[model samples]
Every structure is written in structure tokens, then in C-alpha cells.
Target: MTDQLPLERLALWVEKRPDAVWLSQPVNGQWHDFTWAQVDEQARRMASALQALGCAPGERVALLAKNCAEWFIADLAIMLAGLVSVPLYPLQSAESIDYVLRHSQCKAIFVGKLDEPDKLAPGIPAEVMRIAMPYPTMAAQYTWAELLAAHQPLHEVHRQSAEQLLSILYTSGTTGQPKGVMLSAGAFAYAGSQSVREMQITEQDQYFSYLPLSHAAERFLVEMNALYSGGRVAFVESLETFASDLRHVRPTVFFSVPRLWTRFQQGVLEKLPQAKLSRLLRIPLIGKLVARKIRKGLGLDRARILVSGAAAIPRALLEWYQSIGITICEGYGMTEHLAYGCFNRPGQVRFGTVGKPMPGNELRIADNGEILLRCPSLMLGYYLDPEKTAETITDGWLHTGDKGEVDAEGYLKITGRVKDIFKTSKGKYIAPAPIEGEIAKNLWVEQVCLMGSNLDQPLALIELSPAAREQSQEQVTADLAQTLQQLNAKLEAHERLSHFVVVREAWTVDNGCMTPTMKIRRNVLEARFADQLGELDARQPLHWQ
Candidate 1:
């Protein structure tokens, strides 16, 4: 693939297929398609408007919105204008929003529909220019229509080298403050092209955009891949309409994190009892028909590629999907690497391992068992944080915080995060992820977080599934005790759990327990439960709260 900027590719698509739909957004109750010409025209006008507002080249321009069609347009416009796009998660707190804006020194921000517009208003500086998207929001100086009508379409696209900064993607900050990751234009161009080629994505493939665009995985995988391959991208309206939207789009390619994948399985199990479903699937011909019907019902029958990443998925969950003829390929990557580190290719399938490194990408395990990667798509550095940047990238290799090992077949299996390993009072270190993954295999367990720190042994905080929550407490406790017994039997002495505490409340983004990408905020959860852990009896095998 040539080292052409995404905007250059968009320009080519506009010239070749002006009428072809590039983006689809749900409005009111129906889906609206935006053609390549429309995207180009709007992005050009957006660039012109930013230029009129005195946004200079290389200056940061923030885009704060949920997953929407305009988010992509704003990103392209920012790149076209030779400005850096700083995408902020819509669910970011007011404090985080202010911190990112101040850190990036963004001169202009494109605001769109948000869950809490009031929280955002106080964060944006009065001096910063605000452009509202099509969504109804009064938190902007100019609406999209007004800006397009007032400004002239910019005919000249700014030529940029591969090393030029494209966007500053902030980390989800599960442990500490979010750091801005500076990714170059070449990184996106290279990663996008590689993803398109590796996944065999083409203009005919359709992608559903439901994950936050601010995330590196979704941005590079879905948005950038679509831009590079001329694929159509469909945006989900809201969580309420997700199932309907998925059914409507029936996208050829689908990617989701492990949490969402588990939820999907839970949804299916809720409708059909697992025991009955398993019994039916034991039949030969009827099993195939049932599996196909089940896949169609989930709107994934048409999906040629189904990927699960952002976090490790349970092997049980992967096997469950595989039983239905859908192989969920688990991938491994990070924001610092443009999410192009390694992915399981079509035929080289591994159940738990995230397949071998992509073409031209180097993956080597450090002496400490941490994964080290060297790739063209690696980030330039962490924005304004030279010291941390140096710690992350050394000797031309990105030090992935994840601890993993490459198997004999070259497939990488992630063990856990280095920082997530907690030491017990006995001085033994335990990797919580594996234990958590094992506990999650029990269908009743929705979310599990293992913590020990200074405690004598590891303890588990588990959030039960909705179905499990409805069951009698005694029955739930008994099932969990059995599950814990099975899990502990396979674990080493130090890795064994002292007790399993049933968390009454579910962890959610709204409650500050989970990141926008649905990853549990370990620091937050640990802090919240710190006081209670001291009082819990280590002798107890199970505790109901």
C-alpha cells in the first residue's frame, strides 16, 4: 500500500464514486446515508471554517462526541486542515475534559450530542471556538449547517508527511490519569492499510460503528479501515436500539470487546436455556440448523469476520461462539501501537491466543515475560510527557505493559498486565486476570475483579449476571461455591482465593467503576473496596453482601 494520507484516499473515492454511500447514521427512527461526495464537501467546508477561525497547522483541535457520522467528518477535516485532532470520550468527566483541553491547548472543538452537555460546557474554554454537529446541542458557537453555509469549501488539501501528527488519543486511565498518545499520520495510514489487507476488507464490506471513536481500536480498526478500503460505516443510534440497528445493518465485519461478547452470549442464554440449547446442538442436522438460526437471530450470520479484543475473552465464551460455527478471533494490541500488533488471521485460528504478529511487525518476549513490539504503526510518543514516553519506548521497541508469551506456533497468549499482579502477604505474586477469566467461565459471574495487595490471600469481588441476580441468594451462593471450588482446584497455592464476595451493585461507566470502553477500573474498584477488605474473614470461602 502507498503511503497516502486518509484524506487523499477520501478525495480519490469522491472522484471515483461520488454517489456511493460512505457513512450511515440513524436519525429519528430511520437510517440516513452520506455519500462520498457529501463527506468530502462537508469535511472541506469544516476545514475552511477551522481555517477561518485561525486554527493553524499542527495545532490541536478537539472533537468531543459519541460515536456519530460527524465525528469521522471532523477527524478528516482536522487532518485536511493540517491540524491535530484530539478526540475525547463523550462520557469523560468535566475534570478530565478540562485536563485534556488544557493539556492539548486545543483552539477549537467540534461538539456533538452528549449524555451530559452541562458537564461539558464548564470544561470548554470561552476563548475556544465551538462548532456543533447536526445533533441538537446549544453548547457550541456555530452549528454544522451554519458553518457549512457561511464558509466556502476548501479545494486545496494540505499535504502532510507520514511523520506529521494526526491525532492525540488519550488513554482510558484505569490506573492513573489519562495520558495523551501522539500518533502520526503515517501510523494511521500504515495501520489502516495493513488492517484492510489482513482482514480482506473492501468497498463491499459494511461496518457497524458502535464503539467510541476516541478509542484507538475502534478508530483504527473500523473508521480508518473504512476510510482506507472505501467501506460503508453504520453508526448505532443508542444502546436501546443496538439490537435493532445491528439487525438493520447486518454488517459483514463486526468487532466487539470481551464484556460485550459475554453480554451477547448472556442475551442468547436468557432466551434459550443453555442446557436445552446444548442438548439440541448435540443432534447432527438439527444442530446445524439451530446454530444457523441462532446466528441469524443475533444478526451475526452475515458477518464474515467477528473479532474480540481490547481485553482477553474467556475461552469458554470463545468456544461457545465457535460451537455455533462463528469463530471469534481474539486480537491483541494497544493504543501506543495503533492497535495493529497481532491478530488471528482467517485460517490460522487459535482459541485463546491472539494470533501471530501482523506482516512486518516484530513481537518478542522480554526476559521478564513482557511483550515487546516493533512496528511502523507505533505511536510517536505520549504528548508532552517525554519521561513516560522514554519508559514506554526504548531501543526502538514499544514495551507493552502486558505480560504474555508466544507459543510454539507463534501465537501470543496474554497472561496479565504487569501492574495487575498483586503480591500476597506471603510474598507470592498472583496474576489476577487468569483467575478472573476462570471465574468468569461460570455463566452466573458477569464481572470479577481479584485483589489481594497486602492481604494474606487473594479475594474476589464478583458481580452476578442479571439472571443469577434473580435467583435465590442461597442457590446463587451454592452455585458460586461449587464454581469457586472447581476454579481453586486448578490454581496454585498462592493463586487460590481466600473468599468470593458477591457485589450487590453492578459496575458501570456511570458509577465510575468501568471505563468508557467497558474495562473495569481496577484502581477505582480497589479504592472503593479497600476499607471492607480489611474486615473480611480470610477463613470464609464465600461471602454474600
Candidate 2:
């Protein structure tokens, strides 16, 4: 096996199996397939067009789009032309987008489907060239078809060295300004191979792409893995059609975050009550048949490898899925490491651990309880921020800000974040994540953020799940209060929660309370609820907003 760039792999697939399906997209309630040969031709044409427009090699080009076939084509085109691809999350604010464009000095951008084109148009400077994707855009200089038709197909392949910069992926910036992560071609090639080996991926595997491709986890797991293994990729049309799309694709490999995994469990429980399903599964011969039917209905019957990452999943949730015959292998990684640190193996399952480090990757717990890592796939550094980069990576070890512990069997379990631990007014430090995770075990809670920056004790701001929204407010409050009481009993004196405040407004990407990858923005949430906190007494144990 050669350690070639993704474009080289694409070229190999084009020569070996030109007619094989490379990408699939839904349009007008139907799926359309794009063959490897077609992808190659379009990417080359786009590359040629970029050169015609005076795009120099090593210049930055931005991509702003939702998940689609055109996004992948544009990325390959950028790499083919020897330019760096800078991907912007579709849900990013116009101000943040403008900041990134200015910071990266992007010369051009490929625009695709956006929620509000007019609102985002001002972010891109008029001097920069704009090439519209296969979507409607009023601010583009040329469309996809026009560009492809106007330029010749580029036949000369620009072979990039392993150390060549591949892309600059900006973080979601939960606390501060987003940092541009500089990843090289060699980093991706190494991480991709490791992922394929760990998951046992093959050419026959199918992947359903619904997560934002801008995140490192999705980019590495879905896009890069498919390129390495010559697998087929299917894109979901929209949120409403996710279930139907999953059923249609019946993917062999599935990866999801903690929130979506909980939603899936809630969906199945809604169809068949959890108590009845458990009773049915206890039967002698009918158990296996019933379990298969349930898995099929949830579009997971054909899934060979199920994985979860991006956040700590509740142990109860994993146990529930295991009861139904699905074992979710939790993975641990970050953008700095190309999301390739460690993973729970298939058979040697541990209930509450993220598992051992992968082959060739070194992991250790620091004296301060922070998890440190040294891997071949580690990123070069943060783009244009040498001082910050130096602070992050010291002595060949990348300091993962997360606190963790390693067991005797080499399994690693993340405890909480070092930065996330806050001090109360009483001069005691409390780690709110573990407490929040305990409260999150309650089915009614959709999202929770613990706040106690300078207050006497920590406070929980919660948003109820959709199913819980149907219940009366009184019933919801009673249930939440009971859950909070139980959680407080398990906590120490300083770590106990002072009050539970149920917020009426839902936290979502559009509302700026959530990052693109579905992680809660603690600073944003605290800012939004700053004024109301003064109304509640610190002595109160529970209150409903």
C-alpha cells in the first residue's frame, strides 16, 4: 500500500473501476449516483478553471456549503490545483465567516446551498472570485456548469508530498475565537489507514453522510475513509428525511455523537414502549426474531461497526443499546490528532472507558491529570499562531485539555475538562460535566449546561426533549426536581447542584447556543441567561423558568 494523497487514490479508483459509484445525492425525492470517472473529470475541469481564474498554488480557497456531492468535488478540485481548502461550517455566523476569510486571506470561495445567501453574501469580499456550486447563488461570478464548460480538463496530476499542507480546519470555538488547525496530507493518510484497519472497512462498505463535513471526525471517518477503501457514500437530503435515507442506504458502518444516539433511542422507544420491548426480548426463541425486527426498523440491522464519539455517552445509554445486541465502540480523539488517538476494540468491550491507544500512538496521563498524546498523525500546528501552537504542543506531546485516568488494562476514561472546572463563590472548585452527565440520564432533559462562575453553588439550565414538551409544565418540573434530588445525593458538598432551572427556549445551532458539531457553547449559554440568574435565590434547590 502506498501513502499517496486522497487525489491519487481517486485517480487509482478511476483507472481500476471507473464505472463504480463514488457519490450519491438525493434530489426531488430520488437518489442520483456519480461514478468515479465522472468525479475525476469534473474535479479536473474545476481545477483547470481555477487556474484560468489566476489562483496560484498554495493559495487559500474557501468552501461554504452543506453536505452534498458538489462539496466533495470542490474539495478535490482545490487539492488538485495545489491550493489549500478552507471549509466553513454552513451554520457559522456571517461575522465569524468574515473573520475566518480575513484571517486566512482566502482568494476565492466555492459557494453552495446556504440558509440565507443574502445575509452571508456581505461576508465575502467582492474582490475575491466566486465559483458557485450546483446550487442557486446570486453572488457568484460563474456557475459549476459554466466553469466546467469554459476550461479544459487538467491531465497533469500535481503530486503533493506527504508533508504538504492539505487543509486548514477551523475549530468550533466553544469558548473563544476559532483557531485554524493545519493538517498535512501525511496526517490524513496515516489516520485514514488506521481507521480503516480498526473498523475493518472494505470496498463493499456503504456510508451515509449526514454530519457536517467540516468537522475533523466526520471528514476523517466518512470522507477520507471512503477515499481510502473505495467505498460508496450517500448524502441525506435534509433532517426530515434522515430515517428514510438511513433505511435506503443501510450503511455497513455508522458513527454518531451522543445527542443523536439518544434521539435514536427515544425514537425506537416511542414506537415500542421500552418496558414491553424488554419483556419481549426476554422470551426464549422469540427474543432473537424480535430483536432483528427492531434493528431492521431502526436501519441498523446491516450495520457491522457501530461507533460513538465527540462527547461522553452515558453508560446507561450504551448498556441499553447493548441489550438490543448493538455494541457501540467509543472513540477518543481531537482535531489536533486527526481524531486517531484511541478506540475500544470490537470484542474486548469495556462499559465506561474510551479504550486503549491505537498502534503506534503513545498516550500518558500528566501530573495535573490531563491526557497527553504523541502520534504520527498529530497536526503540524495552529495556522499563523506560533505562540499559541507552542503552548498547545510541548516536548513532542499534544496536551489534550481533558482530564482522564488510565486503568490497569490500558483503557482510558475521560473524567472532565480542566478548563471546564469552575470555582464557586465559596472558594471551592467543582467539575460540572460529571454532574451534568448524571442529570442528562433523565429522558426528559434535552440539553443541559451547568453554571456557577461566581455564584454560591452551581445552577443547571435545561431544555426539555420534544417528547417531554407535550407534557404539562407541572409534571415536567416534578420529574426534573426528583431527578435533581437523586443526583445531589450522589455528589459531595461542594459539587452538589444548587438549583435546576428549566428554560423554555431550545438551544440550537441557529440560536448560537450550540456549535456546528452539536456541542453546547457554555459561554454563550451563560451570557444568554445572565440577567435571569439574579432573580433566583442561591438557597433555592429547584426552580422552573
Quote the RMSD, in angstroms, for model 2: 1.6
Q: 1-545, model 1: which lDDT tens digit per residue?
A: 56667877888899999999999999887888999999988999999999998999989999888899999999888988999999998888877888899989999999987877986689887888888999966467788999899988897879878888899999978867889999998999999888888788999999999888899999988998998999999999988889988988998989999888888888888988899899989999999999998898888889988888888899999899988888988898899988988998877889879999998799999999899999999999999999999999999899988999889889999999978888889999989988898999988888999999888888899998887977798898898999889988998988888899998888988789998777898888889999988888666789876
Every model's TM-score: 0.98, 0.96
Model 2: per-residue lDDT, tens digit, 1-545? 65767877888899999999989999767999999999889999999989889888999999988888999999999999999999998888888889888899999999987778878888888777888888765479889999999888888857887899989999988878889999999898888877787768988999988887888988998999999898999998878888998888888888899899889988888888878988998997787888888788888899887889998898889998988888999989998988888889888779789999987799999999999999988889999999989999999899999999999999999998989998999999988778888888888888789999888778899988877887788788788889988988998888788789889888988798998878899989888898998789766667777
Candidate 1's error at 436, in angstroms?
1.0
Clashes of each: 0, 0
TM-score of 1: 0.98
Off by over 4 Å in 1: none
Residue 412 shift from truth in candidate 2, angstroms: 1.3
Model 2 misplaced stretches (Cα beyond 4 Å): 537-540
Q: What C-alpha lDDT does candidate 1 achieve relative to the native structure?
A: 0.89
